[model samples]
Target: MADPAALSPLAELARRNDPDRFLCALFAPPAQREVLFLLIAFNHELARARQAASNSMTALIRLQWWRDAVEEAATSAAPRRHEVATPLAAALREGRLDAATLQGMIDAREVEMEEDIPSLPALLAYLRGSAGGFAVAAGRTLGAGPEHLAGLQALGAAFGMAALLRGIPAQAMQGRSLLPADLLAERNLTPSDAARDPRQPGTAEVVRQLAGEGQRLLAEGRARAKGLPRAALAAALPARLAARDLARLASTANDPAQPPPPRGLGDRVAVIWGGLVGRG
Candidate 1:
């Protein structure tokens, strides 16, 4: 049995991102490395929390606390009582991590606490949460070089976009949509029209088109990702697979004869390994 205390706060962070689970057998860290994923996972969770909140005030409060915790860890040599922050500081002590990354992570989360990002361009700006912040964190894990950092930024953007796409269904249901409202309007889809049930053909068509756009973005990002830092490449490849599989699933007919995309681990691995990882 592993000693619970032997694990650090960063490990706890990985759990926040559900890093242990993979859809397919394609690309993943070895089991031994699984324990090291806590910090990345935790950062993902905090980012998600900030994004999901409907209220700016609530988001601001949560971000302020996280920011304070990060600051606390940066200055003090010892572990502070804060959960995510303490382990982060501990990780830095063990490794030659950057000060800017830590501050960037906090700042990214802080900005997302407010919910005003509505357009495609604005959405790109709002992505400091995963792309900008995690790019720094990812560099820390992958030898902390400039190339690695740059790769992680592109990788992080691809990963963040995958999650953003998932929220479309949920957002549609809530009537507070995020499908690049202008884009949807241009596609002849009113906000009211896209929110219709998934079983309906219209909604399914919208998903198909959106999924296509997502794949296009992933393709462009993946092309840029080649020759990136190996460590950063490791981080980004999984999302590439995710985007491919999701696009395939969305492209399928919404009819009962065709099943929806795989929600299981096996399908995920197959997609990643079967050349879908980098395919647009």
Candidate 2:
């Protein structure tokens, strides 16, 4: 990791916008750390596209630009000249990254465009493609072999699910909902209903169900992450943070609107300990 006093612009961006992954990247070699930030920056850009653009049409246009950029990076020596795009292209040219994996990250955002998730399975697929895809990319950059990819992906998904749970209240307040429609339906609720009042019994139950799934994924990820190489394990460190958040959420009666306070010191310690021990 770069010195805290002399972070590169990309490193600073990751540190501010993605603290969990940023902490994990600190465990990687210096060269790999820079490349990991490139992926982090790219993912951040893709993540904000929907909010940045004026409409869904504009968002699709922006996402398509990324798709085209990824294609160019994969196929040619020179890709687009944007900050994140240029570095991403370099990673692609160096064989540390691939177009399909990056494309899958973009494809997963299509679900975000929908007003409501259709089912728990659909939400899982979206998280796997977006967050899981990102971890796989980072693991590859950190020199992980094929055998470690699945575990890395699962760890990433666990983090993603936990994150979504934390953000539910904010999303609902904005007239958006990430709760799956079918899950809500089982309790005689709709996404809009949940959005209007996430603390209702039905919505709370859905949150618990989601939390349970996150715990299962976290356990599975940790199990599979056993014996992973040290560098590769860095990419799975977010699972540690996820486990912490899930435990807190469960204790709060799975209330989507009542997130636990941010655990800055605990987060840093958890990532550091997990890194040193090569455990997610």
Candidate 3:
């Protein structure tokens, strides 16, 4: 278990907003764990930008602010003074994180603000940049070798797909749907209609197709992770949680309208078990 006193404010933020990563971080050595916390917390902040903003332009402005902050952090001795930025700047300076990859993450979120995803390939690209890219950064922070980074990203994408599917209900309430626009169109549904009610005909099929893709990615990621260093396991461990969610998705008949059950003791136990096994 992670000691509360040992967690920095940023790490606590990760614990509150991104508990799966937080639980996985506990398996790392203290210093690496702190970097993991910073990375995940930074991601949580990026994810919130769209919802926090009153309009699309405002959301772009918020993302641009983070981009400038990241640029400054990578080049300047005196980086921005924000809580997350301070340590993130230190990580950028220390080479524990990469500037271009971080930039790519920002780009992904910017794309996410769009209502139409166009195609399945385009949607996967967003997942690759956002979740998969973030995992690659975290894996590096935990001393994962360059060779394992691609697999780490794949693992993260799998987790991202699961997360996206599970959040459909909440996102719908907010007038957003991440489903591929083309897929929805084939069913004669618009993004707004799917957002309003995922249980409507053809919506469940979209969810099913996405869930199947998530499972495929999980398998490929697991195969690739077999070669990762033992120390890198925690960084990739969220795939286990993804697997569980993907499985539940099938049991629920792949209903996008069905909200995910809250994470409980079983979820934590699964992370612990995945950590022990050194596979996600």
Question: What Cα-based lDDT does every candidate model obtain?
Answer: 0.51, 0.84, 0.86
Candidate 3 residue-wise lDDT, 1-280, digit = tens = 8778977898889999998888988877766777888899889889999989888888999899889888987564587888898888988998888889899999999877776688999989999899999888888877888878888889999999999999999989898898998999999998888988889968888887888899998888877767788787887989989999988775545667878888999898999997887777
Sorted by TM-score (best first), the order is: 3, 2, 1
Q: What is the lDDT of residue 57 in candidate 1?
A: 78
Tens digit of lDDT per residue, candidate 1, span 1-280? 1244765455544533544222211133344244236446546656666566667777777767666666666565566566555555666665544556666666666545433334566555545345545644654554435544554565455556556555555654555444454555566665555555434454455556656655555565556555654333345554545565555546564331233344566644544553333331
What TM-score would you give candidate 1 relative to the actual structure? 0.69
**Candidate 3: residue 69 Cα off by (Å):** 1.1
lDDT of 1: 0.51
TM-score per candidate, chains pooled: 0.69, 0.95, 0.96
Query: Which candidate's TM-score is highest?
Result: 3
Displacement of residue 38 (Cα, Å) in model 1 is 3.0
Worst 10 residues of 1 by lDDT: 20-29
Candidate 3 versus the native: TM-score? 0.96
Q: Where does model 1 exceed 4 Å of error? A: 1-17, 20-36, 51-54, 77-79, 93-96, 109-116, 128-132, 172-175, 187-210, 229-233, 249-262, 265-280
Indicate the residue-level lDDT of 136 in model 1. Answer: 43
